[model samples]
Target chain A: MRVELDEPKCVAAGQCVMASPEVFDQREEDGVAILLEERPGDELLDGVREAVAVCPAAALRLVEE
Target chain B: MVVGASAAGLAATETLRREGYGGALTLIGEEPHAPYDRPPLSKQILSGEWSTDRLPLRRSTDLDGLDLDLRLGVAATGLELADRTVVLADGTRVPYDGLIVATGVRPRRLPGDGAHVLRTVDDALALRDRLAPGRRLVVVGAGFLGAEAAAVARGLGCAVTLLEPAPVPLAHAVGEQVGRVLSQAHLDHGVELRTGVTVTAVTEGGVRLADGELVEGDAVLVAVGSLPNTEWLVDCGLAVGDGLICDEYGEAAWGSPRPKAGGVYAAGDVARWYNALFGVPMRIEHRTNAAEQGMAVARNLLRPEARKPFTPVPYFWSDQYDMRVQAYGYLRGHDEVAVVDGDLSGRRFVAAYRTGDRLTGVLAVGMPPKAIRPWRQAIAARAAWHETVPTATPAAGARLDGR
Candidate 1:
């Protein structure tokens, strides 16, 4: 599993981190999404997909192989 | 119970009542008065022709018949999602079966003592007092709000100067054709229109430009932009972004490791979600978008099982210097544009925007009745570009009915 993010479209909503905490987090100042650990195990794949679906700006994307 | 009795909140409450929700409604707001018209703040309110007293969303008699427990001058401090209650500034917590978060945005403040922003009624009145005759008014940013302010200040006999960092004013939003009209308006009105300029220094009397040019003004109004008021919701642990995260149906799309709580929803400028037509999740802050979305959220909250998707064509308008500018649909990805009626040089015309072969948006200046409904229908039908051109007539304005 791999994760990609678009910083320009990010509004610091922090939804990506809330959906998959193991893979995403937020910066202190604005709460913009920060990738914590990418290429996560299969157990966290569903959560990653949820992160992509909920991002208001479509700022987060998940690449699963 | 509903806190923040703003446009979205009021619309939600009205919609809920219309849909036969009999639950007791408690509406609270920080303002002493009810929610009122905001757009007028830059126009009539700043011109001193309108007063803040006339801006409430509801009348005492109208609200009296609703059987509502309305609290004014109280602010929502925190949300205890577990308890399903919102904590107010006065240590009062109102619990509700469902919650609607519609605390709208405030103007993004700058780090200065004299600079002002135009978002609320108070802001408009303060700016009005500063716009005395012979005063020099410098406006930063050439967006709709800033442009409108420049026009009003000039109308009040003040010397106005507009500064836009972009190559052309409003080119990013409405394309360069409309932006040229803005530049032309300033030129015609004796306004010193400064494009591709930035304000690097500020003082009590004037602002210094990035190029070392001094724009002397008695008052400077910063109409840069706005940010959502979603600080309290960060702790609620829902999917948060530039706004409170909501799904297509305005439902909170929670993340993993965070517990998903039902009945949590967001609306107005603070709510961001995916627009089916735009193909991207965006945060729209226009008045119409908020009002329509508020109604959609209310209906969905009541009957989630059979709720329809929210897809009203995004539209917004501005009143500036005798021009009633109205735009329909989003123009984010538009690549082709054609002027259907009037001349661009006349500072009065309508321009249609298209992405590939699909008609995506239409913008009109000094012309409202011609563009609104057809643009609305085109957006609803996902009409193609070839299907939206104006019918050719003689030099005297063609009939655009078919288009």
Candidate 2:
């Protein structure tokens, strides 16, 4: 599974960083999300999904093939 | 799913898309323009440093590339949870797999005509246009918004009079000692600060205080407060006191999450959720809480597995008269106060709150690091009063010089 982000909508509220720091990180300047990886293994899937759910700007998306 | 394209809605949408759900995504916003930073409206936008074009949460070009059907300039008039559809003001019905209410809050309007309230970009612009040299502006309320408005108006070369009913401006929120300091900031800047004055009635060019003193002005901008935009859900059957009732995860007390109707979520200024620290339901209208809770709702929506509670240390800031006033944690229960650094008389200081040995919260004027460091300690060690001593090594932004 891959995570796709809508950068425009993201406000970098730090919810994703708090939930799963490995998958989601926040830019220092304006607090917008900086997605580390597009896709992750099953171990990180749950976290990536949680990150998506908590993003206030609705900026995260999960890509599946 | 249909979610309002706001701080909370945008966060929820992104979370849904990131969780490997490729279902059809529909985002709608009432404003024709995209979402933008709001806190700056009272500062940068009013000061002419930032323009409306630069205010959107995301640039229009970026929102368009998301491939989701983005609707702007359309208001969501009604919601049929049972039908799993929302009726737009344009007479269009959009079906949603899930619904997230992120309508946010609007400014409270004044009583009579010609009185203005600030909420949206348009509102700020209208006020800015009227704020010219030699014009008189009477702000009714000495809260953060009122203080910022007065400061901005003064900066714009307008005469401003700030009237607050409270003897101390922010005593309810920041304690009496700190509030006196805050009020003095306005007095130092030539703001005609009047405390304990209630505006009984507003006339054409002024407001009449309870003492029969008529305070005159060219225009009246009422910064009383804000009411959440939750009228649409009147029939939705939820416990909405000040705002829509929700759990910590941002799920509505009664609603369906799926398109069919199970788990509905609310965020931003609209959701009054259960708070862990206070042990009672609380509502946070700050920009930080909105974004954080929006994410929490999104995570809980997609996967129930490994869902974490949204227990955030509250933080808020205000920029007034070239000062960056920041605060962290709750100041509600603080009984004892200490001045860790700076002095109120100088109009630059940091006030720390404590309940016994526990540090409850911190407030600072332009001292970001000193204000923020205690929050980390408070959250990490849950530091109480006596335990929270001034460290030898201050954080990056701490002002080291002392009295």
Candidate 3:
């Protein structure tokens, strides 16, 4: 599974970090989301999906490859 | 069964399916249109920058793949807890082993019609049609919703006049120090801001102020406030005041010194749940809260034995022109506000809110999310204001506004 982070759309609410801290982290200067693993394993899929849903800016997307 | 097919309701259903709950599920909503994100309604949606089709909470295929018994265009009029039945507006009484009330809130309106209150897409579209170049927009209630609409209208070349009963636009929400900073964004952008004014009604000419004066405008947007959609919940046994009262676990409860409703829960703007994090019963009306709380309820409802308390540090954001306003934790009822970082005059700063010693909230204007992200953890950790807040301590020469 591949996760995409649209940096410009990100408002840096840190919801992604809260939902799945291991999979997603934010840039310190601006708070834009950064994907730790662009392609997360099955075990991390749940958290990744939750992060995508809870994002206030609707900045994250997941693709099943 | 989920009673409101919006964010909270949709999130609850999604979590249930994601957790491998293959049982029968029903999603009910009053609006005929499928679930869509609301935050954009006042932003690009109202400005005609984004179409309605672009605002779905999730793609249609993903939503339909859930195999929900989709009941749209009908409202859940009555919820009979005793019979374990939910009576619908279309005369269907659906039973449920577990139920979630995510009916959410409706925008509080002024007296009379023609004026707009934006809670739904239709409301935004209706007001959007009236707003054009050189049009005059009289906005009542300088809250986030009102301010956002005003910004959008102004961007579209509408002459915007924002009215707020409070001296500062968001003084009641964010303290006066921060409110002044953000409210200035409107003024600098050519918005006529009238503070400390009570709006009586929507008149034929425009908005009628309490002082027998009419603010003439081509269009009026009443972004005053919202009330929980808890009328149908009346006489249904669960305590309903400003919102449906819930325990820390998001279960519907009776009253003060309350008893829990075992299988019935409430989430989103419609719920006033005990936030053990802040030791307060908070009913957050933000989009993020609705989604997060909905997931929390679904998790607890599935495994009541392994339930976790819904102690979320609430977050909210509003985009008005170039200024991006974001906040973490609760701001209402805060006793102290300290500008820990940046200057309000620059329109780029962060303000920390505290009640007693505990840090209750943080407000950041035009700062990067990363700058405010650490504060979220502080607020969530129940950090002390003096120690945890950046540059807000005595050693840092903090100027704490007791107001």
Candidate 4:
């Protein structure tokens, strides 16, 4: 799975980090999402997809390979 | 099958597809339009910053590709658990292999037609049309929706007055100290903040207060919270108190035997489930919880054997003018609040809620989101109040005197 994050559109709701802590983290200064793992294995796909879906700002997107 | 095609229903449908549930799936919604994001209805939509076209929760193409039976403008009148059928308003019964109830809540409306309640897109559009320049907009309740509506009306060049019976505007939800700060923030933004007052009646052109005082306004907005949409499930035999009671795994905890293998589940604001983390049962009305709970219920429906409890750390955020208020965790029985960072006087700080020693909840006003993240973790871990070191100088703690 490939993850794409648009940091400029993030409202720092923290849904992404809550859904997928291993794949996403928030910047210390502004709380914007920071990508930790761009390509995660199958085990983490569900979490990553949830993070993308639950993002209030629609900042995160996933492209399945 | 999923009912109430809004945030929770749409999320559940999407999750079922993602989880490889290729069997027959159906989504039922009373509204004619597809599921749409509701948070912006009071903020951007009312302020005219965002168009109505941008309100949909999912793109049209994505929804079209879901390959599920979409039943719009059809209301579920009753549920027959004996036959696993949902009776519609038109007397047609739809059968399902498994059922997921995500029917959200409806806005509590006032008695008369003088006030408007916003719960749907139509309500927002009607309220938006009345927010003309130089008009008076009196909001009945000072909750999140009321405050946001007042802020939006003020931005639209309307005179906004927020009425609340409590000492402070969000006192019941965020405690008095933080509520006072937020009340001041609204006052700073030129909102006519009225506290310790009650509205007796809504007149044609204004509202009558308890003290025989008449506050004349062009429009009145009734923002007094919401009630769960559980009236249709009266015969479903589910434990419907304030909401549909469910187990931690979102299964209906009803009947004498509490059927474990049945395909009935509940989620979102309409479903009150036991929260293991807080050791209490709660029905969260926030959008984040709705989406998360919907997904959790969908997973449990697909894999009943390995069902996992939906114990999410409840989080909610509200935007009023330039101030953004965010909170996480359960703050119902908190006894004390400590300002760990920033100054309350500046209207930018992070406050932690504690019940004796365990940190129960956290609230941040105008603070960055990153600062609130660790507090969420701390609350989930049940960290001690003293363990959270104050990062700001001159730490100020406020004791919640009553409640």
Comparing 1 and 3 on TM-score, the stronger one: 3
Candidate 1 chain B — worst ten consecutive residues by lDDT sum? B394-403
- Give each prediction's DockQ, rounded to 2 decimals: 0.01, 0.13, 0.60, 0.51
- Candidate 1 per-residue lDDT, tens place, B18-42, comes to 6789888887787776767676788
Model 4 stretches astray by more than 4 angstroms: A1-9, A21-29, A34-44, A63-65, B255-261, B389-394, B397-402
lDDT of 2 by residue, B176-216 (tens): 87788788878888899988888877887799888888899
Report the candidate with higher DockQ, 1 versus 2: 2
Q: Give the clashing pairs for model 1.
A: A11-B242, A13-B240, A13-B241, A14-B240, A18-B255, A19-B255, A19-B256, B35-B57
Model 4: share of native contacts present?
0.48
Ranked by DockQ from best down, the candidates are 3, 4, 2, 1
Error of 2 at A58 (Å): 14
Displacement of the residue B348 alpha carbon in candidate 3, Å: 1.2
Which pairs of residues collide in model 3?
A30-B370, A31-B370
User: For candidate 4, lDDT tens digit of each residue in B70-102?
Assistant: 999999989888788899988989998899998
Q: Which candidate tops TM-score?
A: 3
Model 3 C-alpha lDDT per residue in residues B1-403, reported as the tens digit of each score:
9999898998899888887789999999999988888998999899998888777777788788999999999999998877788999989999999999999999999997789889999998999999999999999999899999999999999999999998787888888867887888889999999999999999886988889998999888988789999988888878898999988999998744433345989999999999999998999999899889989999899888899999988888888898878888988888988777777778787888989889889888877766787788898888987788656243235465645
Q: In the order shown, what is each candidate's alpha-carbon RMSD? A: 16.7, 6.3, 2.3, 2.5
What is model 4's C-alpha RMSD?
A: 2.5
TM-score of each: 0.80, 0.81, 0.95, 0.93
